[model samples]
Target: MFAPQGPTLRELAVQALSSVERGYDLLAPKFDRTPFRTPDAVLAPVSRALRELGPFDSGLDLCCGTGAGMGVLRQVCRERVTGVDISAGMLAAGRARAGVTATAPRVEWVRADARALPFGPVFDLAVSFGAFGHFLPRERPELFAQVHSVLRPGGRFVFPIAAPARPGSLGYWTLLAFDAAMRVRNALWHPSFVMYYRTFRLADVRAELTRTGFDVELQSLPELGRRPDGSPRCRLVVATRAR
Candidate 1:
């Protein structure tokens, strides 16, 4: 769902047809008004979890389109917060709307691909929100490695992951249909808009994070509620760089 000021159907269609970078550029100004933005409900609980795990110094928000996760980083990290993304438009939108108070840490924005992040191991905390679908499964190793490379020893790479929809459920079919449509679209389209809903499985991702040198743990976010099976609706993946 979108607000009245959000991108129109025609605009969304145009964005779907463009390359990922250009599409986000066209959509950036209206992004926070769309359902695509990470909601406060998710961010709040993740921030609480990070606060318990932290008292951290420098933080990084990887693939931080419009910097929703930067707010979370600002809460738990004391010194500085940096948001990095591949889209200049997204970074510009985030910068315009940052509204940082004087008490908060210094905030910086950089335009760079997540597969090859530009920072050294200077961060004590790193967070990403709702941006992984842009990466293919095969690209997970490189992506995880880049995050690992940017974090200091014992620093964390954190993000939330929802439980998969139950098989035969409406949510399950919806994600399946979306991924199938994306595969078909990429097959026919140029520049390959790479968003897909179903390819980032938890088990596979956990294995990749481990192979990339993170000590992985999962923390349940109770505020998001639980499924009928008593499983958490969402869990934070807390992957620490090896000390």
Candidate 2:
């Protein structure tokens, strides 16, 4: 659900039809008003978890659209925070919201492809929020590798993973239809916009992270609560670089 200040239905339709980069460009100004932005509820708990992990220095926010996750990084990181994304519009929006001064542990933005991140092994922590759907299953290896390459030895890459939408639920059907529609659109369009809600499966992603040499751990986010079956609704995937 979107607020009154958010993009209108027509604006959303236009964005949906455009390439991912262009769509985000058109939507950047109003993105926070929309439901697409990661909420504070999610970020707060994640930040707390990262604090428990603690003492991280430089941090990177991969695909850091509007830098919502920068709040999480800034809280837990003792040094600087960097946000990387492909969309200049989104980066500009993030810069405006971030309001970083010219000081230590300051915020900086980098425009780069997530698959081909442009950075040295200079970060001790990396995080992504609600951006994985843009990547296909096969692309996870390279993306994970890119994140792995930027982190310092014994560094961490972390993010929260929601439980898969249960079969026959409205959420399940909605995601299914969205992905199906995106597939058809990509099949017919040029410079195809790739965003699917269901492509990032937990098991496959865990395996890929393992292959990329991370020691993976899934810790329950109790604040997000559990499901009817008493399983955690959300889990934080904490992947540390193997020394």
Candidate 3:
């Protein structure tokens, strides 16, 4: 669902046909108006969880679209915050919205690919929001490694992941249909826009994080409540760089 200020159907169609970076560029200004932006509900619990885990100095928001995660980092990190994204348009919107002043923790925006981060051991905390679906399952290792590379020893890479839908549920069918449609679109289109709804699995992600040298833990976001089975409706994956 989108707000009155969000992109029109035609604009969304155009974005879907473009490459990921260019698509995001076109969608940047209206991104926060769409449901695709990380919900403040999720961000709040994640920030609370991170605070319990840290008094971190520096933070990085990987794939920081319009810098929503940067707000969370600002609350948990003490010294500086950096937002790295590949879309120039997104970075521009982020810079405008962030309004980071000299009084706040120094905020920097870098236009760079997440698969090849430019920083090294420079961050004590990192957070990504609603961006993993852009990468294919096979690319997980490299992406996780990139985040690992940028973090200091004992640094954390945190993000919220929702519980998977049951097989016969409406949510399951919706995700399946969305992924199928995306596959069809990618097959028919050029410079493929690679946003899928169901590619990132928590178990697989945890294993990949471990392989990338992170000590993984899952923290239930109880504020979001629980499913009928009693499992958390959402969780925060806290992947810490080995000390």
State each model's CA lDDT, in order.
0.94, 0.93, 0.92
Q: Write candidate 2's Cα lDDT for 7-107 as tens digits.
A: 99999989888888999999999999999999998999999999999878899999999989998888888779999999999999999997857656778
The total number of steric clashes, by the backbone 3 Å criterion, in model 1 comes to 0
Off by over 4 Å in 1: none
Better of 1 and 3 by lDDT: 1
- Better TM-score candidate (1, 2): 1
Model 3 is weakest, by summed lDDT over 10 consecutive residues, at 98-107
TM-score-best of 2 and 3: 3
Q: lDDT by residue for model 1 over 136-240, one digit each (tens)?
A: 999999999999998999999999999999999999999999999989999999888999878888899999999999999999999999999999999999999
**Using lDDT as the measure, what is the rank order of every candidate, best first?**
1, 2, 3
lDDT of 3 by residue, 1-243 (tens): 889999999999999999999999999999999998888988899889988998899999999989899999999888999999999999999999977587657889999999999988999998999999999999999999999999999999999999999999999999999999999998987989898878899999999999999999988999999999999999999999996
Which pairs clash (backbone N, Cα, C closer than 3 Å) in model 2?
none
What TM-score against the true fold does each predicted structure earn?
0.98, 0.97, 0.98
Model 1 TM-score (2 dp):
0.98
